[model samples]
Target chain A: MADWDWDFTWEILPRLLAATVNTLLAAGIGYIIAMFLGLAFALAQRTPSNTLTMAVREAVEFIRSTPLVLQIFFVFYVGPEFGVVLSPWVAGMIAIGLHYAAYLSEVYRGGLENVPQGQWEAATSLNLSTARTYFRIIIPQALPPSIAGMGNYLVGIFKDTPVLSVIGVAELMQTANSIGSENYRYLEPYTMVGIIFLLISLPSAALLRSFDAWVRRKLGMN
Target chain B: MSYFEFLVAHGDLLLSGTLVTAMLAAVSIALAIVLALTAGLMRLAPAGPVRWVATVYIEFFRGTSLLVQLYWIFFVLPLFGLSLDKFTAGFIGVGMNLGAYGAELVRGAILSVPKGQWEAALAINMSPLTRMRRIILPQALVIMLPPWGNLLIELLKGTALVSLISVADLTFQAKQINATTFMSAKAFGTALIIYYVMARFIITPLMRWLERSMARKLGRA
Candidate 1:
């Protein structure tokens, strides 16, 4: 077994940290896409058209059932033949975002479902337009219950960012891989990447738990 | 080549790859269930070191990314003189990570069991071990079945990471075909369809049947 090398560890720290920003960026951008797309998906299922609902629901199930990495590959590779060429970063973001959006839509669906049927009836009784009912009355109520699941997926999206590295996105995992290969030392880089992930995710999870509680209280839901 | 031709040429390869994928998923689920049971029981134990240790293990595993864990085991463990073959490393990573999630489900399911059931068991003068083995676990098992089924699907998808570690799973075969033929559409599209079929057709039906059987066994059907 090779002895530990502190100097090599110190030398690689800066590069990994730089890549950390890119990892966060990818997660953040991907999350933004998922959050909006997920809402659309959740709402689509509740629409009046049977074909639209079934089609979207099946799409969500298919997406959720498959692996995220394969989706990343599909988007990156298969898009070209359809004349939808995209850079690695762009493709990675779409794939990751779409994958999580499927999961989040379920969360959204649950939240929306819990918004008592009376609320919908009340909105109709008020003669409010459909858009106004959803955006103004219904969504505000759905927001609190959705916060916890949304927060979980936020962390989930953060952790899955490493998969983007497979497509050469220059994120932390990719950076770690390149660093290890360049120096013929895989131990330090991979460990550092793990440490970085743990440090961020653990606290954010705790924070999210408290945030969920806080949102509930603010909405007076107990 | 057309997607049909691609499948005709490489159907056997694809099927064998899927067999490996299914095996990986099966072994990993078994491993995860064992770890989850152990750690889950630990987390619920009377407040002590075991509980604390379980808490730490769950948080540590759940917090870190899976790919990093796989890479560390596959790449870095050998530096410390513990060498695992690639398949062993693959399932261990996927199993242990999912096990953390499973542990929570276990904890939740157990807690969901009515406190009255425990009190009744105590009134019957059942030994602690027997009480848990007979009453608590049976009730908890029913409550946990649905979530466990979901985790099985997740476990199946997780086996895909093994391909990255160079395991010859379904995904590895797809990537291989894509590389050779540059037929990204036929290769990846076909792979996607197969995955969708396995998940939607096979796993979903299987889970539904299991859920129904468990509910019936529990007399809640």
Candidate 2:
């Protein structure tokens, strides 16, 4: 068995921890963008005009079907060609956010579908405006069931932050890669990154599960 | 160069890369299914130690990022006098990662098989191994196939990550062409379309067929 070197792990612990902050920030901002944009896309698909709805649906499907890493490379590399230069950080966030938005839109669509038809009829009978009906009747009920799905993706995006390393985002994975390349010892660095991810994901997963259970109970679901 | 001219010139390279990507995804998923089935069954084992081992394997692999795992297997293991080729390492890393996820699906499907079925198998005096092999596993396979198909598509997309470790898959080939021609649009654009076609034309149809066949078999029974 190979004896792990504790001194090396201890020395690099702070650096990994520091990079983890960037990872968390990226996940936070990306998730926020995804949440809002996902709603926009989902709403766009349900727009009154058939042409607008079809175009939006196709665009979302295309984005959803492609690999996120390739999307990141495309946005990061192609943006400058189109006279829209973005830094690696911005590019990474946009790519991750857009990719996840396509997914979250589906979640939102499912949540919206779960809203019973009678609720909309009741809102109509009350002479509510379309916007008011959506805000007061539909969205309030649709949002909660989708919370668990959204939370899962939050953890997913957190886990996928390492992919941003391909664009040199200086997140935990990038930091580990550079450290390994410089020192020629990947054991400590990669293992440290794995530990850091477990530290975050395992706890978040447990919390999400409990939250899911609590939500189910609140909804009177078994 | 025009996008058309660039694509025409580099068409052969892109095609070969696409072929490699498909082959890698197919092979890795085949291996992953076998691993997942075994580990997943072990997860439901009556023995406490067996279940613990399976849980540890799944959590440890699923919790970490695939990129880190790929780098470790491809780059780090050699330091400890255990070395694998780049292609082997890529396959192992992706297979293990997907296996961790697939195992959960397998376990869920198995458990979803009604308790009455288990009781029936036991009442018939079937051995535990025979019951699983003849009854539980067959039903679980049908239930597991649809989700496994989705995971297979995910695995296909994931193979692009192998390029980072020098596997020369589709993404790597596109990067190579882009570097030489500086036609990022054509190179990457072609790669993306190829992936889309594979997923839409091939994987999706195959999954539908599997779902139909499984449904038919269940109905016949």
Candidate 3:
């Protein structure tokens, strides 16, 4: 154990910190894309047209069933083959966004299911339009329970940002791999990478838990 | 090469890779179930220290990324003069990581088994071990299988990471074939289809069947 080298750790600390920013950027962009795309997919599924809903559901399921790394590689490599060139960052965002959108769509579906049927009926009785009923009565109540699951996926997407490294996105894990390859000291780089993940994930998990609790209380489930 | 020609040439390699992936996922899930049960039960232990130890183990594993953990186990541990085979390292890493997630599901399922059942077992003058073995465990297993099935699918996806550590799984084979042939469309498209078939046709249906059987046994259906 004494073979562990502190000097190497110190040397790579700055590089890892810089790469940490890239990881955060990837997670933030992926989350924003997933958040909106998920809502879109959910709404698409709820659309009145049967053909559109089936197509959307099948697309979401296909994305959900496949591995994210494979999806990342597919988008990164295959897109260029089709004459649709994308930088690694853009490809990674699209893959992660599409992948998580499938999951978030399920969350939204559950949230929508939990919205009391009477609420829709009551809105209809008040002669509200379909759009007004959704915006005023349905979405407001349906969103909170889904927040916990959505937050979990946010942390999940954060953890999974390492896969972006495969496409040369220069994230924290990629930085660690590069540092380890350059210095031949795997301990510091990988351990530091793990620590960076723990530092970010643990706090975010706690915050999500509290937010979940607050949402529950607001819904009068407390 | 055209996609059709590429598929014909590399068909056997892709098949073997898919088999390797399925085998790895099966082995990892098996190991994960055992580890999850042990850790989950420990987490519910009456003794504070035992519970604390389990909690810390689960948290530490769950808090970090699986790739880092895999690299640490595969690359760093050997530096400490304890070398592991590539397959063992991959299996253990996947098992340990999924076990952390599975432990939570196991704990929740066990707790969901109903308080009165435990009291009823005690009232029958059964030994605590027998009570758990004969009554609690079987019911918990039924409840746990559905979530465990989902975790199993996650493990299947995770097996792809083993390729990074030189495990020669499906993703690795695709990458190799792609590098040689530059037929990314054929290689990855086939790989994606294979994954879809496994997850959709096999695993998802199996999980639904398990859930249905459990609900039937519990008379809840």
For every prediction, compared with the true complex, DockQ reads: 0.84, 0.67, 0.76
lDDT digits (tens) for residues B61-168 of candidate 2: 888888888988887788788899988898988899999999999999999999999999999999999999999988898888888877887788888899889887
- Pick the TM-score winner: 1
Model 3 Cα shift for residue B85 (angstroms): 1.8
Query: Candidate 1: which stretches are off by over 4 Å?
Result: none
Expressed as tens digits, the lDDT of each residue in A1-222 for candidate 3 is 637688878888999999999999999999899989999999999988999999999998888878899999999999878899999999999999889988999999999989998998999999999999999899989998788898889999999999888899999999998898888788888888999999999999999999999989988976
Give candidate 3 regions above 4 Å deviation. Answer: B216-221
lDDT of 3 by residue, B64-150 (tens): 888889999998899888789988999899999999999999899889998999999999999988988888987898888877877
For all candidates in order, state the fraction of native interface contacts they contain.
0.89, 0.59, 0.70
Model 3: lDDT of residue A51: 100
- The ten-residue window of minimal lDDT in model 2 chain A covers A58-67
- Please provide TM-scores, in order, for all candidate models, with all chains considered together: 0.98, 0.96, 0.97
Chain A TM-score values for every predicted structure, listed in order: 0.97, 0.96, 0.96
**DockQ: the better of candidates 1 and 3:** 1
Q: Residue-wise lDDT of candidate 1 within B7-105, one digit each (tens)?
A: 799898889888999888888988999999999999989879999999998998999998999999999999999999999999999999999999999
Better of 2 and 3 by DockQ: 3
Candidate with better TM-score, 1 vs 3: 1
lDDT, candidates in the order shown: 0.91, 0.88, 0.89
What is candidate 1's lDDT per residue for A1-222, written digit by digit as tens? Answer: 867789999999999999999999999999999999999999999999999999999999999988888889999999887888999999999999999899999999999999999999999999999999999999988889998999999999999999898789999999999999999999889999999999999999999999999988887888
